[model samples]
Structure formats: structure tokens, C-alpha cells
Target: MTQTAPVMRDPGEDGRFGDFGGRFVPEALIPACEELHDAFRDAWTDDAFREEFHHVLREFGGRPTPITYLARLSESLGVRVYAKREDLAHTGSHKINNVVGQTLLTRRMGKTRVIAETGAGQHGVATATAAARLGLDCTVYMGELDTQRQALNVFRMELLGAKVVPVTSGSRTLKDAVNEAMREWVTCVDDTHYCLGSVMGPHPFPWMVREFQSIIGHEASRQMAELGVGTPDVVVACVGGGSNAAGIFAGFADSTAELVGVEAAGGAAISGGQPGVLHGMKSMLLQSESGQIEEAESISAGLDYPGIGPEHAHLAAIGRARYVGMADEPVIEALQLLSSSEGIIPALESAHAVAWIAREAGREIPSGSTVLLNLSGRGDKDVAQVRDILKGRS
Candidate 1:
């Protein structure tokens, strides 16, 4: 499902993505980030590092997930809907792509522990799985609210030998969990690797995570070509921290394809958000005018983030990608539609993109237009919440 492409390597000097992706972290972590920067830069180009990355990706992490043509869904919607099935990846989401890469790099850096923050626990479980496979110590920080909502993922992480810590501060969700993870990384800088789940974060992280995840777009583009769909008319993905969107969009940045990023309307950073610093990067954030971070709410816990990845901010500013916001109701509708029509249950986070595509098909998308959507994760994590919503509706 994938093939090699000409890689675009950016130096990421001082980690600034057009004034959006700078390292605005505490002074205590500067040296750690610098060490990670140098280590990552060296290892990424090393032959041994490449070999190890490739080995784990193919042998253990399950690379080249399928590009499924959702014919029934397409017929119902009156457009060509193709899905790059990240949901079928190991650990049930696109998150494992970055985790496997980072876990290998962590081993190279002589780090013995891995740490991260999770909103819906997909990232947390992915990290935990990598840590368990590599025999490294793992710990994940999650908001108490999310811990309760996604308790099954907590149990999954525990099964994979990771200890989950609940963050109770602020809104008690992804943001607070990230705050706690950063604090942990600063304190345990020598022995720990912070496995960031998205493309948002200080300089090297945005650049590094994107490089790991760009595999999705790389293979997907090749698969599309093989399918005789030379160039898609549009590419759509839902954005929480923008990792999946960045991965898929990075592949078509130079193509004549139009890229669209979907955000949760309740937590719509692109539409009703401002540029500010949150969690060490300057990007579009839901913040107060006086510069305080605001809490975001969404039916989809994974997309309930206040700030987006810095690379996305740059892409938006440069006109490389258009950002769309879909409200909660539409997201639910899309989730139901895809589940019923295609029998493919998408994560609520990804349903935002489906909702956007549904709306676009109703108006803008011409009949028979080819649209590629990143089915970022499976909806197993969302069954309970979805059931609750449906029952309430009944």
C-alpha cells in the first residue's frame, strides 16, 4: 500500500515554522530538547537507524495498512470515497506509526523510559505497546475526565505494563495531561523520552514526529497511483494535534491536490481561535484575549484540544491546506452514516472529517470527484459514549 517518495527534509533551524513552532519551554528543559534535537538529527540519517526503523515498522508495527475503497458509502454519498485505513494498523490507530519510530529512537538514545499524555488513550496505548515491546519503562499522563471516559484504554495500557497517572488540574483533559507530562520530562530528562502523540510541541518534536508519520502519506500516494487515481481532487483529515493530517498532507503538498483539515467546531482552533503559546509551541489556540489558555469541549474527546500543531498553523498560513470546522451534531451524523453504509466504524475524531466531506459533497464536491479521507482510528473506543448518545436521542 506504500512506496518510497522523494523526502523533503527541512532543517527546522531553531525549530521555528514561520514564527509558529518555536521552543517556548522552561529553561530547565532546553538542554534536553537540544540533546534530543542533535540525537534525532544524527540517528535519522544513520544507516543503522534506518534499518532498525524499517525492521520494526514491517515486522512488528505492521506497515502499509490498506487503502480501502468505500464503494457503498461512495454510492450513497454520490462521490468517490477512498480511505487510507490507519484504523487497521497495530494498536488500532495511526499513533503506532510515530510510537514505533520514537521507541526505536529512544532505544538508540539509551533512554530506558517512555512518557506521554493522552486525551482519548489511543496515543497512550500505542506508546505503552511500544514500551512493552522494547522492554522500556512506560508511564502515561491522562486527564481524570478522560481516564473515566476511556477507562478501557487505561486497562489496555496497564495490560501493556504502563502506569497511567490522572491529571486533575485545569480542565482535567489532554491539556492538563500534557502539562503534567512536560513536567515529568523535565524532571527525568536523562532516563526518559517523551513520546509526543502529535505534531504540535516545541521545535524538534513537530519536525521529528512528522518525519515518522509521513509514511502514511508516502504509501497512500503510491497506492492511489496504482489504483489509477493519479491525483485526488481533495484530501481530508481530522485534526486534534494535526499529526495524521500532517502525515497525509505532507505527501501531497506539492501536488495539485486540495488539502482540507477538519477541526471540531466546539474546539475549533482554525475558525474561532487565536495564535498563542500553549504546551511549548506557538500555534492556533483557543485562548482568552489576555493570553490565558481556554478549555475546549467536544463530543469527540480526541479532538477536544485547545491548540493545534505548529506545522498546521504554517500550512494554513502558506495556503497549503484549508481548515474546516464541523460541529458535534454533524460529526455524530457522519459517524452513524459511515457505520451503517460502509460498516467501517471510525473514531469520533475522524468522523469530523467525514462530516466535513458529507457537507462538501452536498454542495461543493462534484459528482464522481475522488476524495481521500484518512480513517485515523477505529471506533471501539467510542462505542460506550456513542451508545450513550444514541440512547439519549431515543
Candidate 2:
């Protein structure tokens, strides 16, 4: 997750990113959020703290994952395609980067346990791994449906000594898992840190998590320059809670590159959403006219959230970045195409970016344009689910 550093458009002290991001949590958690804000502020400025974070990411979690040029796929699409290979990072996803930083912050805060919400379970696995390494108790909340769909990841988390609690509330998916986690966090805010999986959530979380994940963009920016590619024409990544996209976008926000966030068609908050607040942040959400948060359905469990990170909403509002959605049909086709052409299978969430590039090539993307796609996660955890879906279709 290492990269060259770039200045980000950080929110004000009030955490408002142009009317999009702000704290909207229960009173009980305000003190905790304040404490986290202060702690992060201090730790982020301290050279020692920054060194420890990078050291752990480099030595324990794999940092500086390579950027691979998709030669064949580029030729087929009539665009030069390159992938920022976060799938090769520890725990097989970009989830490891934020968790590693958060778990370290947890230890610094003298917390003894970590609680997290997961949909596809990569965050859970990464949290469990970091907790085990630091000798802290780890518990993961996942929707009952996601537990069934992502059983392999559940097993992986348990193997790493995490307690997996299957949430059985509304929808039984990422949204429900978040509800359960937030409820649990209120009860154990003193002794446990709620390790939010994405750049959503309240106040410092969206900002803090983006700061942690900015390594992706920072590194990719420098790496692209080193390869004589300079800045790309477009930078694309899948957006669930939008952490990966935020991370990669931070690298090129000030550049000439166009930023595009691809979302699951059924859960596209930025494209098919309204202004609303959910999970403590005011962002674009898939909600009904009555302001009820709708259940987001997607073939990718990780991208099944009802809302996007607040910063993403701000970006879209200001015309800094554009977002689009991809249906399941083309997403599946894109995954197969990448697997066969590049010999690299992407997680269903990550495949959304590939799907967008493949479908938009020579159309919205222009011929001979250089495209940078964030390969956010690997397909190992999704292989079984994809198999089931493919078999059922057959």
C-alpha cells in the first residue's frame, strides 16, 4: 500500500466536505469520536507513529504491490489498460491497508479488543490478522446472508482467531452488518475500537481511513511517473463505501487525469442515490422518498452497501469525479474476460471497474486513452460464489 504522498482535500475540523460529510452519530459515541479524532491528529503528525505504520505495512502486510500493464486487454479494448495490483496485498485485498493502520491505532489507544463489520469478509480477515499480530481480541460482525455467500472468508477469519457474529436483522447484508456493529460499538466504546472497513462512517473515520488508504494513490502516482507514463487519462476504481477509490483518487486529484468511480448497478449510491445520512455520515444513499434506507442488492457482497463515503459525494457534487454503475451481467463477463485474457481473476467488487472500462472503451473512454484501474481485491474468495452463480444460470 506504499506510494508517493500527495495532498488531499481534507475536510474541515467539523468534518464537512462541502455539505456532504459530517458527524451524525448518537450522543453516547460523540466523546469516543472526539477522542479518536484527537488521537489520530496526534499520531498522524508524530514521525514515530508514521514510521511504525509504514513499517508494519511493509514488513507484515505487503506494501508497494506492483502495477501491471494489461497488454493484451489494452489491445482488445483499444485503450492502454494498467492495473494497480492491490489484490496482491496482504489478505488479498486493499482492506488490509486500513485495518493495519486502525489496529495499530487501537493498540496505541490502549484498547484491548477490535470490532468490525464485513460484507465480503476481507476486512474481517484483515482485522483478525492485525489483532492476532498485536495480541488483541477480535470480533467481526457479518450479515447472515453474507456469511453463507462468503463462507470461505468466514472460515479464514475464524482460523485467524476472530469471533464471527452473523447478523440476522434487516436485509442480512452489509447494511445490516453495519447496524449490528454500530450497536455493539456503543456498548463497548471504551474497551473496543470499531474498525470501520471503509471510508464511510462518522467524522474522523472517512477522513482517517482515506488517509490510511491514500498510500494506494500516492504510490501509484509515483510509480506511473517512474514508468514514463506520467499521468493517466482516466483513473477508475469500484466504489462500495468508496475507500479504494478515495485512496487511488488521492494520488491524482490534482492531476489532469479524470477520476471515475464504478458502482454496482443495484447499489449505486452516487449515480442512483439521493442526499441522505446513514452510518453516521451524510453522503449519497440508496434511499426511498420517505428517506428510508433501501436494501442494496449486488452480486458482489462487498459492494452491497446502501451509501457511499461522504468524500465521494463531495467529489461528485463538485464535478471533480464522475460515477457510473454496472449491471451484474457485464460484471460477470468482465471477470471472465480478465481471467482469460490477463490470467488474473478479480473480486466481484473490483470487476466493476474492469467492467466499466471494457464496456466504455472507445466510447466514453476514447480510443488510445491510458486508463488506470484499481484492482481492489482478488477473486479467491469470490470463486466459489461465482461458481454457484454460473452453475445456477446453466
Candidate 3:
């Protein structure tokens, strides 16, 4: 196969990162998706739209997120570790970044409703927050299992006036929730914008989602430069549908930085799975010989997924990133270690990357090599689950 120059993109038509991404939705939803695509294109190019979006990010979503050096972690790992604190965002997760952008576009498109899916409920909460702020009706679809697991977030969404619809289909988790959300979007496409939480999905979604999230990498790059570190030697982030990782990797794509995407070993799609379709996009997925999506196992509710974003599939195939896997045990260990050592407790989703640094890699990342990890969210959402793990609850 011949390698071609990577394609840079405009927002609408067919959203792609290379040939890997395209809108592959149900026929009924195509026009709605196209409308969203066009709206995002115009919004992205409009200075006023850009200004309003940035203004919200600055005042509400917390723009210019800080880069914190983990001195103790660095001393222990032999690498200068820094964390891009997306966890510090208002909703305590990076999911708000995309939610804010999509909500703005939703208003611009004259949409009166917002629909979304959630795994850890971070996205649901983020979407609900945006909906409440914009006074749009919001509905969040979550797997039954997730609703139970992330009950606090479910209540949080409800408290914010968003309805949480519990889906009990398939594995009854993130994937099922995604299917439900898509179905709802198909039915209500005229008045509903599906606020996708990740850089996966089909076509314009992955592209548009990444554009919103690019703020992370963009701000981090500028901050690092100001700190007199031109570029880090490595950029690390945990990948579920690969949004946060993509966000942090986008700005550094042209630099010499070694991008690393950490996957949950129990559900390590890149290292353990084949290319397949799920939730409308084709990518690496843990699947059976019969091509059914396999059940994923990760201590982190957010990091367990059968499929990844298509661009991540492309990146993994092309060696643009070093994808590594860390199992359940080490992820727990990292969560505990971070809490004890640094007085910082990270969401288990983000801790999966910290696990890679803590135990997965055979050697410590080299001394003086600056490594930036996208700490995607706070750990408050996972306290109950972690307590269960600690107490040996099933």
C-alpha cells in the first residue's frame, strides 16, 4: 500500500482523518448530520462564533488549563512528568470541552434539544450542564449498568434538569448507550443535536469532536513553550473512544514528541483486537470470530470499550503513536499511588495512563524527558466503584 500525505480537513461533507473516517449513519439521519456538519463549518470559520465559544471556555469551562509538573512522580519514574489538567474543568472532565462547542452549534442550528450517551456519566453530566446553561431540553442515554455504577452523576444530570434514559440493551454499557443515543438522534434529528463525548463515531463527528478538543493540546503547547520547554519528549493520555488522547496529540502531531495512547489491558482494543465497526464507525475492536463486539473488562468504567476512534485506528496502523495496554490490577495500583503520593486522586479512566507509567512499561521513561498526561477528569465519580474494589465487592 502506498502512503499518501495525511489529509487536512474542512468540517462538513465527509469528516475524515485520512480515509478512515466518514459519516456512516442510518440514511434517515444523513441530512441532519450534514446540517450539523455545515453549521460547524460556518461556526468554525465565523469570528463571532469563535469568540463566543472561547469566551465560554474562559469564563465557564476554564480555559488556559494549567500544566502541572509531577515532581514526585517524575522522581519515581525517572521522567519529568507533567499533567494537562483537564480534570480541573468545571465539570471535572474534558468532556465539557466538546459539550460546550456542540451546544453552541446546537443553538446556532436552532436545535431545541440535546441528546447524548454516557459511560462514566461524565459526558452526560457535561451535556446536561450545557443544556441547562443554554435552556435547551436535554436527554442522556446511559446503559443500565452505568446508571447504577455512576448513580451520583445520574442524579447530578437529573438535578440539572436533564433526563437520564437507562438503556438495557446488548452488554448494557457504553456501546448500548451509544446505540440508544443514535436511535434517538435519528428520530429527533430535526430538533436534537447528539453531543458525542469522544473522537469516534462516524465522519464529521470524529472530526468535529477533535476540533473542539484541540483546545487541550493547543493550550498545553503554548504553556509548555512559555515554561521554556519547547516540546515534551512524550505525550500520554488514556483512550476510550480516543477523544482526550486525540486532543492532546493534535497540536504535537508535527513535533518530535512521542505520543502514547494508553488502553485498558482487559479491554485493550489496539493490541488485542481487529478492525471492525461499532457505534457507526469502523476501527480496532475487541470482537469474536463471528464479528460480534466482545465484552470489555476494565476497572475504569469509561476506559472499557470494544472499539476506538477511526483516526486512532489509522494512527495505530501507521505507527504515529505508541499504543500500550495496562491491566486492571496496575490501574488500581496507580489510582492508589497517585492519591497517596501526590495527594491527587485521578479518575480511573485517566489513571489507566498513569498505570502505564506506574507499572505497564518495563522501563522508566528516561530522565529529563518531559511526559504530558491528559488527566481527563477527577476521581470523585469513581469513588464508590473503587471502594467496592477495595472491599472485594463484585
Candidate 4:
């Protein structure tokens, strides 16, 4: 495969990446979105705000997560593989990175309360943790199915003093939870800032969330250099709303490394989707001929969404990154392989990347090349579901 450096561009002043992203929300929320955009732009340029945000990350959310070399797994695959250990972050996931940054942004906007939508519940837990620390009211909307599947996370959010509202609309999944959260934001925009969990949604959010989570890629690149390794041959991360993938991609967007985003086979929006609008952004979405969003199914709740971040759509369009899909069986197998071989248990969402490596090794990806995988979160929250899957398989 030819490796060429990609030119990375932030969204235009109108918050568009080519033809993918824009503010396609109700007029009532336009002013709120604009206010957030201005506030974030100003704060992002302020050194004090940057320092404070970095300070909070280091002191609270555990910044500078390590990159593990995964010797045995690499040996098994006949390739050098490194895992960016976002699982070691304080909240056991990369979700906390964006949450902490946005929590600070919420405070800067003088918002007294923050609301969010969650799928696997990691985002809700992170948002709740930040809100509790900052003394802000927090409410998390989660699909009823997700709340049940990730019950412990619901308890964790409540323990952090946040209300967890089970959303019973649509498919009872992430997209539905997002729908409810957007509605809640419309009614409570005055004092309640919607802390969107992923790098989706309207205008500034995709840009702002990427800026916050980009730390993962930045740190991974530095850590790899410290270990005497050059830039990776490829950087891989799973994409649902694409926050983690976008985060890691930001660091290497201008590099020669091939950026690969793995998606759930059952919900592979970019791989099997058409251009359409959903969640306030025009992105690649799994929709029917009539433009109705299709229900996405994936064993990983975090990847069970019909739409992807608009930036991902732009990248794919411009040939800056490659997107692929992995089914549940391989994801589960990859999860177990990492746990058994490297003694690292990865979140199912993260496992999709591993599954891709396994599927492509020595074929699509040549052996001995270096691969950097974003281990987005731990698998503790998925242990029960995986156990059931394993049981049924046996």
C-alpha cells in the first residue's frame, strides 16, 4: 500500500468538512451552539485555560496513559503491535478525557448543569465523575437496553451523584438515547449544557471533542518515540461515534502512517452506509432507501449506532483513512486473546481494532510492520455479557 502524508483541515468557519458537517438543529438551539462555539474558540486559544485543562487531566483523570508493547500478541501476529493504554485512565477509559475538558467548558459557559447521552455508560460515568468533582448537576440519558446491560455503570453514575435516565424510545440504543438527550437540551438549554459523549453532533462539538481527546494520539506518538520506534506503519482505533479513533488520528493526521478505523460489522456505518443527516450532522449513516435511519445491532453497546462522526466521513472521502468492519465473534475472540496472551482485557469497542489486526495480519497488513492500536477502555463493564456469549458458544 502507498503511504502518503494527509493534509488535515479543521472544519471551515461554518463548521463544515467538505459536505459532511453543519448545524442542522432546531433554531431554538442555534444560539446556544453559537455561544458554545465562541466560548470554546476563545478558551482554546487562552494559555491559562489550556494549562488548567491539562492540570485537571493530570491531577484527576490521569493523563499521559502509557503505551504497552504487547510482546506476545505481536509475536503471535508476526508484527510489532503497541496498545495505547487508555484503559488505565482514571475512569478506565478514554471517555474521561473529553468529559473533563467539556466539564470545564460547561463551567466556563456558566452552565450550572450538564446533561449527556451514553451507550456503554463509560461516558456517563466520566461525565458524572467530573460533575461531582466540579459541583455541577449532571443527568445522563442511556438506552434502556444499555442501562440493563451496563447496570454497574448506572450505579457508578448515581454514586457520583448524577441522575441516570433510562431512555425507552426507538431501538433502546445509543442513537435513541441521543435523540432523547437532544430533546432535553432543547428544553433546558438555558442552564443545562449537553455534554455529548462522542465526537458526533452539531458544529463545534465534533471539533471541540476531538481537540480534547486528541491527547491520546499526541501522547502515543511521544511515547513511541521514547521507546525508539519511528512513526507506526498504521494507527488503528474502533469507531462508533469515532471519538477515540478521531482522538488518535489527530496526532498522526499529517503523518505517513495509514489510519484505519474499525467499526462493528453489524453497525458499520462508513463501510455500509450512505451520506445522510443524523444527530444534527450530515455524515455517513446506515439508512434505508427512504432515508430512514436503520437500527444498528452490535454486541458492543458503544458501537451500536447507525451514524458516525462527520470528520470520519470526510477522511474516508479524501482517502486519508481506511474504515473496515469486524463482527462480534472476532471481536470477542480478540478480546479473549489479548486477555489471555498479554494479560490485558480490552473493552469490546477496542477489541474491534484488534480483530482487524488479526484479520488482516500478513495479508492486507504485511508482517513485521508496526501497528498502534488504541485500547479505548477496560472490559470489566463487559465481563458479564462476554461470559454469557462464551457460555452460549460452548
Candidate 5:
């Protein structure tokens, strides 16, 4: 196969990637957004700031998460399967990568408090951990339903010294939590920073978050070279707001590796959506023909959202990355398969990618090809839920 590098460019001066991604936020929040954008731009360029960020990552969040070669799974699938083990990071997921960067940025901006929204609660836990470590106040908004489903994570955040607010409005899921968090940030913009969990929000957020999370791909690429594995034939990661996917993709974006993003079938914006504006950005969203945002349903709270990050939308539009969806049953089966075969249980969100590989490895992906799957999180928090699901099935 011929190899060509993708055209890599930062979002234009308007914070756009092609026709996707822009500051579609309320006029009242524009100044705050601009301030954040400027601060991030300046901080990102400073060597001292970069050193400090990496220092925090190494000393606190556990940087350079290893890439595990799945020997048994590889033999079973007739392909070389590897997992970039973000689940091994502190806080049990890749969410900490962005949280660490944002927390430092908040302190630099003279903010005393940080507020965030979460779906599966991983980001909330991560943010809360950073806040506690930095001695900053933290608050997290979670959908009522998600808080119930991910009760352990909710408690974990509270234990980390964050106030977890249950948002009961709208669909009572990630989107609603985001709405409430944005409202709260608007009221307290003077002293509080909205630490968006994903790469979905307006402007510098998508850009800023991606930069922080790109450590995953950078480390993976370097590790691969050191191990003499070269680049994999494909790179795969699950996408909610596309932080992990975007992060890992960033490393191989300009390379020949095929980038694939797995989304929950019940909430796949790119596969079953149209262009619409939601949560302050223009991206493919699961919306009604009348333009109302539809409620996305999925067993994985982290992947249960109506829209994706704008960069993922742009990548799909430009054929730089392929987006696929997996239903809940296959994801559950994949979770079990990985647990039994490799002794590694992945988060339900990450299981989407594993499920795709389980179904398509030898058929769609050629035999003997190489595949890198971003094991985005551990399934410790999801064990009870999956156990109940499997018990019901039996």
C-alpha cells in the first residue's frame, strides 16, 4: 500500500478545522473563552510551561504508559494486536492526561476553583484528583442517570474533595451535565475555570485538550520504535468526545497508519448523524430532522453522547479516519473476551474498539497485519455492571 502523510494544520485563526469547530458559544462567554485561548497559546509556547506540564505528568499522573502486545489475542485473531495501556495511568484512564494540563493552566490563570462535567465520571475523578493535589476547589456536574450507573466513580470524585452535582434536566446524561456546568461557569467565570472533559467544546478547549492528551500517541510511537515494532498498520481508539482517539491519532496522523475511531452504535454521530450545532461547536450530531438534538442511548456512559469532537468530524469528512460503531452486546462480549484471553478488562467505552477488532480482525483487516488499540480505561468500575449483564444473559 502506498503511504502519504496527512496535511496537518492547527485550526485556522477562527478555531476551525475545515468547516467544523468554532466558538459557537453565547456572547456572554466569548470574553472568557478568548482569555482562555490566549493564555493557552502563550503557555503552550513557553519551554518552562511545557517542562512543568511534563514534570507533573511524570511525577503525578504516570506518563509513558506502556504498550502491551496481546500475544494470545494476536494468535487467536491471526493479527498482531497491541494495546496502548492508558488504563494503567493513575486515575485508571487517559482522562488524567488532559486534567493535569488543564489544572496547571487554571492555576496559571489565577483561578481558585475548577468546575467540570462528566459522563462516566472518569474525567470528574481525574479533575478532582488534580484539584486536590493542587489545593484548588473543584466541582463536577454529572447526569442523574450517570451518577446512578457510575456511583462508585461519583463517590471517588467526592472522596477526592470535589462536590458532585447531579444534573436532572434534559436527558439527564452527559449532555445535560455539560449544560449545567456551562451555566455554573458562566455565573462564576471570575474565579472558576470550566475544565471541559472532552475535545468537544468551543475553541481552544478542543485544541488545548488534544495537545495535553497527545502524550499518549507520542509515547506510543517512541515506544514502538524502541521495541523495533515500527508503526502498526492501524490505530484504533473509542470516541466519546474523541479525546483519547484524537490524542492517539495525533501521533500517527501524519503517518501511514490507518486511524479508526469506534463509537457506540446507539450514539454514533458520524455514522448516524447530520451536521448541526451542539455544545458550542458545529459537528455531526445525532439530531432530529427538525434540528432538535436527539438523546443518545448506550450501555457505556462515556460513549453515550449525541455529538463528537469537531476534529473527529473533520477527519471523517476528509477520509483521514474511519468511524465505526459497535452495539452493547458485542462490547460486553469483547470486554469478557479480553478479560479471559489476556487477563485485561477494558472499560465499556474501550471495549467498543476491542469488539470491532473481535468481529472484523481477520475478515476486514488482513491476516498478519498489525493493529494498535488504545485501551483507554480499566473496567474495575464496570465489573459489577457487566457481571449483572452477563448474569441476566445466562
Candidate 6:
């Protein structure tokens, strides 16, 4: 048997990251995906397109979000901690960066509407906001259960004039929401663009979304350099579909930073899952013995998925990054801890990374080493859920 050497270079025509990514959609949608791929490629290279994208991001999406030092957390954990505050970005999450870029691409493709799937609701809200700004009609599919849990964001999306559809099939979570979104896109491919919320879908999509979200990593890297820490010992972010983690890791992928992606224990695909296909791309997935896709359970809606982004699977495969899981109990504790320690409340999805860092302070991560964390979103969306959890505990 021969061990396949790590291939970390850009994926070519096959649109793969190792054996994990490619287009696997309905026949009717292949042309749409290809169109999107060609448009993105041209737009990505065109100076005017690049300038417009950056201009929109700076003028509307809020680029270059600041970094904050978690002094109290660093003191308690014995690991110097800094956070790239994507939470402070417009729309209160890193989702805005990807959504802004995708929405711009949507108009470039002459699509009059955008559709998206969201579980935690941040992406849906961001999509709606961007669509409204661009005068494009927006529709967001969310799991029925998630719609109930994240009702506030549902209202926020509607307030931005996007229609919200609740998906009721197959566990009624992020995965099902994605299924619904894809089904909808197949029927309206000509006029609607599926603004995928993560780096989990077919070809072009995984690559495209990552490129949009890469702004986070690029900004953080320069900020770290400006702060006198040219490179940190570790770069950490939570992974569900892995967009935010991929974005932040992109900045440090070639560096000596130990890239760490923390997943909800129930959905720790890279650590506990097998290679399987879901949401159009083959990646590490939580599956049953017969290869049935399993349901992922977590208190955080954003981290509630059965698989990880294909690129993340590749990263883990090539040993370029490490993946770990954190349970719900510690996620709550970490969220509360950060809120109290630094007066900053992190989304439940982001709290998984915080928990892992605290849990691994002296174990996987050496003490006194500088660690950079991507605070992917603010916790306002999760406050009600947390309040209920605390009430139940009491």
C-alpha cells in the first residue's frame, strides 16, 4: 500500500480538495453551477470586478474587523489569547463576508433572486441584508426546528424582505435546510442563485465560498503582524460546515501556526466520521453502519450538521490542521466564561473553539504560547437559547 502524499495546492478542473470536493448535483443544475464557476473565475480575475467586490465589502459589509486581546481568558488559561472579531463585522458574524461576495456575484450572473439555507440564522440574515441592499429578491430555507429556536433571526430576515421557508423533513436541521435549498434551486435555476451559506457544497461552491470568506484570514494575518505577533502558535475556529474555520485558516495555512478546527462533539466529522457524500460533496460525515447519514445534535444551531466542509476533510487528511470535538456542556460554560471574562459574548458555534482552547491549554497547546481565535459571530442570536438552558439547569 502506498500513502498518498499531501496535495495542498489549489484544486484544478475536478474542483477537488484531495478526494473530497466535486459537483454532484441534479442534471438540471449542472449548467447553473458551471455558469457560476465561469462567472466567479472571470470576476475574480477582473480588476474592476475585484475592486467592486472590495468596495462593497468596505462600504457595506464592514471589512477589517478589529482584533481583541482576551486578557482575562489568557490569564486563566495560561495561553496568550487574541480574537479576530468577526463578531463585530456587519450583520454580527463572518457570514456577512461570504454573503456580500456571493450576492455581488449573483447580480453579476444576472440572477434576480438569492436563496440560502441557514440553521443558526446568521447566514440567512446576512443574505437577506445583502439581497435587500442589492435589490434582489431573497428566500432563505431554515429547518423548522431552527426557525423555532432562532425566531429572532427569522424576523430579522423577513424584516429585510426575504421570504423564510421552514424545512420539515429529515431531522429538520441544517442538512435538511440545505436539501430544501438545493431542491428549490433546481426548479428556479434561471432566475435564482443558491447563495450557499458554507463551504460544504459541490465544486466551485466550496472553493468560491472559501475565497469569499478568506477575507477574515487575510485581515487577521496582517493584524497579527501589526500587533507584533507576526504569527501565532495556534489558529482556532469552530467548524460545522467549516466556512469560518476555512476562512481564518486560509491566512495561516502556509505558516507555522497550528490550525485547529473544533467541532460540536455530536458532529465531529473529521474526528469521528467516515468519508461520505452529503450536500453534493464527498467529505467526512457522521454516518450509521449501513452508511446512512446520521443526525448531529448540539445546543448550537450553527454547529448542528452531520458533516464538515470537504476542504476541512482534506486539511485533516494531509495533516495540515487538527480537528477536535467539544461537548455541549463545555460549550455553554465557555460562552458564559467569555461573556464574563472579556465582556464579549460569542455565538454558541464559536464557543466550541473557546472550550477546546481552555480544555487544551496545557495539553495539545503549550502554555504561554500566543493563540489566535476567530470569534465568528456575536452571541445575541443564542442568548435566548442560553437563557433557557440556564433556567433548565437551575
Per-prediction TM-score to the true structure, in the order listed? 0.96, 0.97, 0.95, 0.98, 0.98, 0.97
- Report the lDDT tens digits of candidate 6 across residue range 1-394: 1224533345777789977898888899999989999998888888998788789888887787999999999999999999999999899999998888899899999999999999978999999999999999999999998899888889999999999999999899889999999999999999999999999898898898898888899999999999998899999999999999999998988788888999999889988899998888999999999999999988888888999999999999888888988999999999999999999999999999999999999888888999999999999988888999999989
Clashes of 1: 1
Question: How well is each residue in 107-192 modelled by candidate 2, as lDDT tens digits?
Answer: 89999999999998889999999999999999999999889978888999999999999999998888988989999999999999
Decide which is better by TM-score, 4 or 6: 4
Note the clash tally of each candidate: 1, 4, 1, 0, 0, 0
lDDT of 5 by residue, 250-320 (tens): 99888889999999999999999998898889999999979999998899989989999999999999899
Model 6 clashing residue pairs (backbone): none
Candidate 4 per-residue C-alpha lDDT over 135-191 given as tens digits, one digit per residue, 9 for 90 to 100: 999999999988988889999999999999999998888899999999999999999
lDDT values for all models: 0.89, 0.92, 0.85, 0.91, 0.92, 0.91
Greater-TM-score candidate between 1 and 2: 2
Model 4 residue-pair collision total: 0
- How do these models rank on lDDT, best leading? 2, 5, 4, 6, 1, 3
> In terms of lDDT, which candidate is stronger, 1 or 3?
1
Report clash pairs, candidate 5. Answer: none
How much does candidate 4 score in TM-score?
0.98
Candidate 2 has a TM-score of 0.97
Model 1, 253-337: lDDT tens per residue?
7787788999988788878789988888989999887889888889988898998998888778777778988889999899999
Cα deviation of 204, candidate 4, in Å: 0.5
Query: Which is superior by TM-score, 3 or 4?
Result: 4
Task: Point out the worst 10-residue segment of candidate 1 by lDDT.
Answer: 1-10
Candidate 6: clashing residue pairs, number = 0
